[model samples]
Target: MAHKRFAQIPMSKRMRELCKEEDFAFLKSQPDQDQSSEESKLQESQTQKKLERDHRQEERQLNEQERQREIEEQKKVQCHAEKEEKWKSHVAELAVKREAIHAKLHRLREFRDFQKKVLLQDLDPGSTNETINHLLMRL
Candidate 1:
């Protein structure tokens, strides 16, 4: 066993499980079987490494997807909050505008009422020269 030359080579788990002396004697008696065992052990080690790499890659992809989803969710929440704030501000502004319109209408009604009173007074039959002059000016 040239252990110094192959320090990194690991013992095969499958071969370790078949630790009977008879198993090794039989494999040694058959050269093809011994070579096949060596090849299979190397293949198994490579397959294991590949599986680990695939698992790590899959985990990374899943983590990235979750992070993206969280970002999108946060953006949606922020946009919803902004829209609500804008809606509230617009409602407040409309309320102020509506109050201003109502105040103008109230003033106009008061002025119209004053004009009606003045016209009624002028139309009175007991009124004299000033009422006749006012009526002639209206015509």
Candidate 2:
């Protein structure tokens, strides 16, 4: 029954009851040591929580920066596509203008040939058809 009662007490308190006076003085300070150890553990837990919060904030900032970079890249790609389309349109317009200029130059050449034929006919009213054809061929 006495053993059962001793077992009911905590191990440290049991040691305190059995210890000499000098050893009891040392055991009496055990609670203060336990309190200081608990305080250190609490400070360590708070520091760990603060570090975790800082790490989470850094991750969020990095994610936002990556998102911004992707957006800027998309904008650059869109702008480049727009510029390429405009360049192709301008090239097509220039081709059309070139063809129109070529057609005008061909018409001008035909008109000049017709004027030369008329001038030759006026200059030689008695010329034979064969002679006029031969002169035109030489021209």
TM-scores, all models, native as reference: 0.53, 0.56
Tens digit of lDDT per residue, candidate 1, span 1-139?
A: 2336545767675544455455668767665644677787887899999999999999999999999999999999999999999999999999999999999999988976676567667676677666655764684
Model 2, 46-139: lDDT tens digits are 9999999999999999999999999999999999999999999999999999999999999988976796679676876777767766766686
* Model 1: colliding residue pairs: none
Estimate the TM-score for candidate 2: 0.56
lDDT (Cα, 0-100) at 74 in candidate 2: 100
Residue 68 accuracy (lDDT) in model 1 = 100
Look at candidate 2 and tell me the lDDT of residue 77. Answer: 100
lDDT of 2: 0.80
Leading candidate by lDDT: 2
